[model samples]
Target: MSYKWLKFFIMWLPVIVVGLWEYVRHVFLLPFISMELGNFLAPALVFLITLTLTRGLFAKLEQMQEALQRERLSKASFQQREQLARELHDGISQSLFLLSVKLDRLEHTELNDEARETTEQIRKTVKHVYEDVRQSIANLQSPAVVVDDSWLNAIHSAASDLLQNSGVHVQLDWQLPEGVLTNKQMVELQAIIREALMNVRKYAQATEVQVICHQLDDDGNFDCEIRDNGVGAESSEIEAKDRYGIRMMKDRAEQMDWSFYITSAKGEGTRIRIMSGGDKNE
Candidate 1:
């Protein structure tokens, strides 16, 4: 039965049983039973019937209600995913297509050495943009937000996929509490971390990479940092070589109103930190 029907029946069961008992007592049982005794038995009988029927019915009702709640949540998640996928397809995907066309036209006309180098750089940037957009669209279409630790798993999966054969020893130091980030925040952070790790895999040449996530304070603030002990670049070189990926990460953090910082020196290493505040438990 439906939860509503089961609930209604449970609610009115006592009244229904009592009414029937009273009618029977007045019509027939009056010869053998006193009015006071029937009145006393009526309550006991109602209580017994309610206790017998409602126990299993209440349990079933609870299960049905929980199932309904889960179904609603699933539909909401699906709707959110569809909206995001549509936005990405209409905005970034279309822009990338136009940029790719322009890059192809630019590739056809090769002249001076410097201009050729710049064109090549633009081509690389376009390639990265296309790849990133495709990844974002895929993530939107099939998000793994059902489990509480799905975001963490995604971070680990990204790290594994990128650095598996690169001889980089990656470490994940995840210490954030469960349900600390909203779905949007989690998606943003996952993308940022994946990008940071991809940068490390491509350019860092470091033997050790650390991905750390931790709570900053009691006010629901947290920090996520990606550090690598590799041949770090100078500020100018960082801007030139990894600008596209870095810019994308920065834009993501900015969209969420989070603080993003990058620290890299000649030989020390590189560290990218993203910090955000407020309770994002959703």
Candidate 2:
């Protein structure tokens, strides 16, 4: 409101200057108002006009700057929420499913020393749940961590929860130099990796898994491959529930204009490849 008044006053500046000039010329006689003093006052009046005009302009610019900052903060908050949702789906959700499977086995399976073994399995599964909760709390405290070797630390952080909770083994190998992929790209890529690993833990009765990340120099593209030695499915046949994760991985990869593909066989293991444009400066 005060700034608006400032603008309103400035709007009449041209008329004010003319009125003041007429008053000075007529009311103050030639002898009283010296020519030298009049010349000095002219420049002073021009300076005051410039100052008033700039005041309103500066106020408008300040308001625009503040609004832009607010918009950036809101966008950042939204991105963080999306990332958190993916984490829960990939980490804690899988752990719960595993717990349910364990309980199902305990309820149905029969053995000589069933009670003791069943109790142990249930305890271990419950312990995994506790550990995942603690890890989730820690993640809430610290959103991300980086290793000395650039993205390596980020990849480790991404996989830590899944490895701790799931029975399957994961092995990571990468040859990515620093500044090959931007932080945002790295995060989305890591989320896709976690999703693939989660599916393996939940569905693939695998014993060992391998993750490889490499960049293709010819086209400045990154290639990530995840392979597991588990009961795989036909690439052509996908169940409705399993397809959601696949679609999500593809969607995230597409955010960076990357490519996502999957390969599997009934007896052979499953492999996922996510190729991204490897320009870190973006």
Candidate 3:
């Protein structure tokens, strides 16, 4: 039998036994005692015991429900990480490899100054793509841990890493409430933030960027914003044709049932935000 059913049977057994004892005392034992107090005391004892057992059963059920939820979330996270790994390997990694080969061939040919500079740019772009591909693979392989630190730390770390490596400056002003996030949510949030930072590095070309993360008053609702001050929309339209980072970020947010918004104006900047109704207690 399932543990829930077994626990129910165990908890109910005491009530059943107590009820029988009370009935016997009132119907038979009370006559021997010849006291109305025995009848009252017997039923009172039964009631107390039954109440305790019922509370225990309810507590056990609550614990079981929490455990099941955590298990389901863990399984889902593992599956998603696996799928991301496969997609990165099959799609981005393969494309980067082909691009590298093309760049190598171009380098071997003789070219004018302009063509040579163009080849160099292509090589740099290919190198950046390769690095991103490697990082995505690494993130997929890394195990997620729940820590008692600020969520902003994770966001800052990702942003800093991207900026330091890609020569982009990210300005962040975020205030988060004192609450923990689940492991799955953290992983999802981390991936989403990383993707946004990558887009800034790859396409934004803005000198400065800003990030914000905060909780809303409603239960389970939270929001994050990432904005950059760079050569914006017009350049972005020309750049978006080859950029998959934004699309991947949106896809990851959608997978977690979150809302994503992005806006940009030419010569102005780009801004991206994600909103979700996700539990914040890890």
Best by TM-score: 3
Q: Rate the local accuracy (lDDT) of all candidates.
A: 0.81, 0.70, 0.74
lDDT of 1: 0.81
- The global Cα lDDT (0 to 1) of model 2 is 0.70
Clash tally for model 3: 1
Ten contiguous residues minimizing lDDT sum, candidate 2: 139-148
Over 169-259, each residue of candidate 2 has an lDDT whose tens digit, in order, gives 6789887666677556666776687678767876678888899988787555778899999899876564455366678787898777887
Which run of 10 residues does model 1 get worst, by summed lDDT? Answer: 139-148
Candidate 2 residue spans exceeding 4 A from truth: 1-79, 82-151, 236-242, 277-282
Candidate 3 to truth, TM: 0.63
Residue-by-residue lDDT tens digits, candidate 3, 1-282: 455765776667767877787778778886577567775676677677777666777787887888788667766766787889999999989998998898889888989999999899988888987887888797675544343253457667777777787777877776555544566667777778878787787777877788888887647577889888877776457347566777788778888888877777888888888888744221
Ranking by lDDT: 1, 3, 2
TM per candidate comes to 0.58, 0.49, 0.63
The RMSD of every model to the true structure, in order and in angstroms, is 6.9, 11.2, 7.0
Number of the top lDDT candidate: 1
Q: By TM-score, is 1 or 3 better?
A: 3
